[model samples]
Target: MRQNDAVAANAGPRVIVFIVFDGVTLLDVAGAGEVFAEANRFGADYRIKIASVDGRDVTTSIGIPLGVTDIAASIESADTVLVAGSDNLPTRAIDPALVEAVKAVAGRTRRLGSICTGSFILAQAGLLSGRRATTHWRNVRAFARAFPDITVEPDSIFVRDGDVFTSAGISSGIDLALALVEQDHGTDLVRDVARWLVVYLRRAGGQSQFSSLIEADPPPQSALRAVTEAIAANPGADHSVRSLAARASLSTRQLTRLFRSELGTTPAGYVEMVRIDIARSALDAGRTVTDTAHLAGFGSTETLRRAFVEHLGVSPKAYRDRFRTAIGT
Candidate 1:
């Protein structure tokens, strides 16, 4: 807060501008801003400025009032410009005034990036076209559908595509800010910041570790729905394509066809996906690796290892370690 108050008064610090709006996510601004602020204590001077479209203070998502440093159109000497995200960004349309303000500031900033759903603002401004980016996992499908030109990395904590970088929301947003600070300083300086903040210098894995894949409703078709329910009820059961087809009262080929048509996967693939979901649950609940493999219906630990790697990109033991790791060293 002190750094933000004295930013314009300081002459030599690199200007960091954040374009905020009404209903802006507070952590999206604070998490990243704190990284730069902590870096300053180590002699990395980053002058933080919070700007709005019309130069008026706005309310945050949590209903806290945030002060404004300047209007977006007046942003200058910005070493980096970050747009904070909002909860309504995914469901509502981007404000045209905000888009124009971002575009105007981009011309002067050396680096342009966003935290959380702020990528939507960058996308709406036509700046992330043909760029690889990411956002909160819940919005990945909608974002990809809305912008066919942008390559959306659905599970990355953060992604750097040339000069425009985008990152996931909340804690992942903090990770992105740490990476930016690393680029300007070095690993040593970033490690100090991470230590001061009591977080990992670099956290493991991606957003997939935190997202739920089994929350969707079961298939609507009775036969397909029955098979899905059976799979979820007892992943340890013998759910071979033949067994499932028999339960669904369809020929093996027809069952395979239905699974492909309605579920986008073969019966065997569907079973594995469900089993993986079960395995993830078991791991998260502190089950032993061997126990998790059997409970999740993997015939052997090796088989379970293969499935986990193929789908989640992390071994079961490694995934489990995520839960065990503490915040501080």
Candidate 2:
């Protein structure tokens, strides 16, 4: 039987604690909340608690308030601690008390995660000094400039550098949470959560930032947008560079230049990355390599395997086995 089948055959409850700071993005908190809350549906006993720096009601970026029952003390007692994103606080200027508190939690927690700008908190607490980390694409330049000592992969949706995990913007928090679910309870449990939430099952934590591939300034005309939509709608289509350019009504050279100028990559490269992203997602959801590649726009399994080897440094089967075997969900 498959690893997912084995995981589903045995599962249990887990504790999750989310920390919310002043002026935090509500969506970041909500995404984490939804994921942990959804764990109960998969036969996992889950208790999610929302907390604050001072155990007070915190105001969100959008001006909403939420009650936080526990302080950073929750982190010490929980199985996982997720730090939610904040709006405009200077990360390095994080409150000294909060910093020490987070550092204390990191020292003892089994799993630690940060969403969006909450990464600043992690960085401030020295949880991500030499660790691979990521945050909102919009904050990449500032984050890099702020913490030159940290290795920041701005393109990743999230980065799991050893024990510390960091994720990009709001919705991507769901992706991070789902990734954690896969890590603990297996992909099947995450898929069940995704289905319940009506979202994509698995967008790999390493997929590119939206602007990493296309348009720093949103494309003026809808033609490029249309082409992008088409590709997503039919990821299995044969989208050669020339053919794709034709669809967008641009000459091949113009298309190439536009992609480089706007998205920082060539058209062929973007297409392949997108295809690989699709394959990664399918694989995470337990699809076989041949099926995933076909669904991801590759012509054959060989093409998929080659790309996986070249870029991800692992065979599809190996990735599935290791990722699954780790959790024993």
Give the best candidate by lDDT. Answer: 1
- Per residue, candidate 2 scores C-alpha lDDT tens digits across 1-329 of 01133223234446677877778899998887888788777766667878776888899888989888788755545567788887675444677777777777665556788999889888887778888899987787678878888998877788897657999877889988888888887888888898999988865434342333322432767456666777777877867778889998999887787777766677777777778777777777778887987898988998988877666656777656545434544
Q: Distance (Å) between predicted and true CA of 201, model 1?
A: 1.6
Give the alpha carbon lDDT tens digit for every residue of 200-270 in model 1: 88876778767765544446655788889999999989899899999989999999988776665778888
lDDT of 2 at 270: 74
Considering summed lDDT, which 10 consecutive residues are worst modelled in model 2?
1-10
lDDT of each: 0.85, 0.75
Tell how far residue 253 is off in model 2, in angstroms: 24
Per-model TM-score versus the true fold: 0.87, 0.61
Top candidate (TM-score)? 1
> Lowest-scoring 10 consecutive residues by lDDT in candidate 1?
1-10
Q: List the residue pairs that clash in candidate 1.
A: none
